[model samples]
Target: MALITRLSTQSESFNSALRTLLAFDASQDESIERATADILKNVQQHGDSAVLDYTQRFDRVSAPSVAALEIERREWLAALDQLPSGQRQALETAAERVRVYHDHQRAQTWTYTEADGTVLGQKVTPLDRVGLYVPGGKAAYPSSVLMNAVPAKVAGVPEVIMVTPTPDGVRNPMVLAAAAIGGVDRVWGIGGAQAVGALAYGTQTLSPVDKIVGPGNAYVAAAKRRVFGTVGIDMIAGPSEILIICDGATPADWIAMDLFSQAEHDEMAQAILLCPSASYLDEVEAAIARLLPTMPRADIIRASLAGRGALILVQDLDEACEIANNIAPEHLEISTENPQQWADKIRHAGAIFLGRYSSESLGDYCAGPNHVLPTSRTARFSSPLGVYDFQKRSSLIHVSQAGAQTLGRVAATLAYGEGLQAHAASAEYRLNLSN
Candidate 1:
């Protein structure tokens, strides 16, 4: 039996089949929603007490107060110090590369004087504080800590508060080390919807954050959705996805493992391969089968492949690029002789990896690009999380006396035409003063 569905563009039912494959039921689970609502409401009203209750109940870690859950700066430094030399070096290297990449994304305030001496520009400013929720316990993601916190720091955020669940009260040292390296100001041993609520609505111990960024379980996602108006959020991400456009030139095993990289994330992740050669697709399938037994997460990879993965056959690379534009996958790998030529044709993808050597895993860990990409075709209109997400722009306008006289007349005319008498009067008053 085949591990993944194989589709041919020549089939009459191809469109319908493709739609079915792409469709993901993103609808919130009713039970989860109700629970999340209750948690958020409780946390908002009761503050630290509510967070403490939920933390104890969910994480099974009793704390005297929310303050007790806070990890000190010394602890973070100690964690970094305790790490094996190799692991510490790797973390530092990844952090430095990420910092360098985000440094290039920083936006500076700019202003230009017009002919009439009117100054107009935009002032770029970072948010005061940001909340980073990292998955903890068995699912420790130190890379996520660097990805989220480092960008916020690069944007010049004054403080970054990190929250992670410590199931059975065992903290992951790597996560703490990452917090230290990424310049996270505070760390709290809290998780789920309660942590999100605490970040959104200030608790007695934990002050509210300007924005919340990071990944977590369903409850955390739900909490972020509910509190969007009160505080900004990075994105309500869907399952991970990877789309590889191969020209049958890359090695089959390399392509197979690349697909597995995303599939191992969870059962809902989608991995699709598009190539002109049918025989190459078969070879990749053979490789997947041969390699499946070796992976520790074989069951998860198998389920993910069986559920949402595909081996697509296109007429040529052009058709494949067209289909890729429509899909707008989170991670797009163009593996061919001249990969950049095909990449130039692509307009909608979270991140484009060129050539056979560029693997998605490298981007996930340390390729100097953000791994927090738009998923489930959201890449068509959205972008990957970056330093931009942590910063905002304010329009600057300083009109000179000469400029006001000239601009106010236009403003008054438009305001009057729109039946806004007060607006017209205000502009006309400015014109009169300028005169």
Candidate 2:
């Protein structure tokens, strides 16, 4: 009777059907690619003039110069003052926690000398500047400002420039307030692929950044993909996804709400549940049907659930964990008596929410871990955004007289084998100089 699909491991055609369900076409739309290419070229060639024109056309913010789009520090503070006391305190608290957590992840430089006087070490340096993209207007998310900027600042990046689309010249005060709280260096009222192009290519007033982070709609995603090599980008993320494995001991309401948390992101977002107990699966399904009418975004939840969401009955919790590894969801919740037991089995997931109390929403806001996670099965190879993403490492090798003689022979041999006479001679010359 439930709108969502119900699958069983006992079913004959489960494997093929599940594969069909999991397949998502990540290829960019050709039309979007063409449009993004044109925008990037315009910004690269015309610089600020192109930015101003696009701002006028898309966001309807027609400032005489791109410089006027900058929301200065005092303006950020004024926006902070506009917030109610409760909202201000909450933003500050969330920012402080995020800062504290990332402080532990900061990397430092180190070196050591050997008996031969050879120095070997690594030097870590923070990026000079980073650009953050936030969905502006009705989609304004204050949490994004804190999540993206705080980590870069914690990593010692000198400047953090944020670009958010302000359709019709309207700005969200809470977003600006979060920028102030997170210590963001600059805020610009801009959005869409044009905003992405400005960040990637740089205009007259806005300097290009070392990297771009944050999320946006389709056009923004396409732009990020195109400008990847010119400027670093975080990742081309897909829809929100959450996979929950429960032992059926936990309350059905807890699991149902956790599933809904991700479903409300959008219609394409995925929320799946895999459990060993069939009765518990039924209970959760009933709970979902009962609770659907209560949610303000019930319409969205309904479409997402009917379209992509699923409830599966697995052979056992072990089998559930196996399937979870294959899916590699962005957010994985293990709600059971022994969450750690299953947690130990998980090979891939962007972030794991263990126990009923550890909801995904907490990670999205105040929880210590970064909420910008790898989505769309990228967890197999990538990881969550953190201070490390804003930092770079350079290897240091200082070969001494004794060390060079030893290192030269090895280097010369490899160089000669590679058919580069100049490289071999360079090492040979160094060897003779030291001898």
Q: Superposing all C-alpha atoms, what RMSD in Å does each candidate have to the true structure?
A: 1.0, 1.4
- Highest TM-score, which number? 1
Each model's number of backbone clashes? 0, 2
Cα lDDT tens digits for candidate 1, 332-367: 999998999999999999999999999999999988
Question: What 10-residue stretch in candidate 1 is worst by lDDT?
Answer: 426-435
Candidates in order, TM-scores: namely 0.99, 0.97
Q: What residue runs in model 2 are displaced by over 4 Å at the alpha carbon?
A: 432-435
Reference-based lDDT, each prediction: 0.95, 0.90
Which 10-residue window in model 2 sums to the lowest lDDT?
Answer: 426-435
Error of 1 at 343 (Å): 0.5
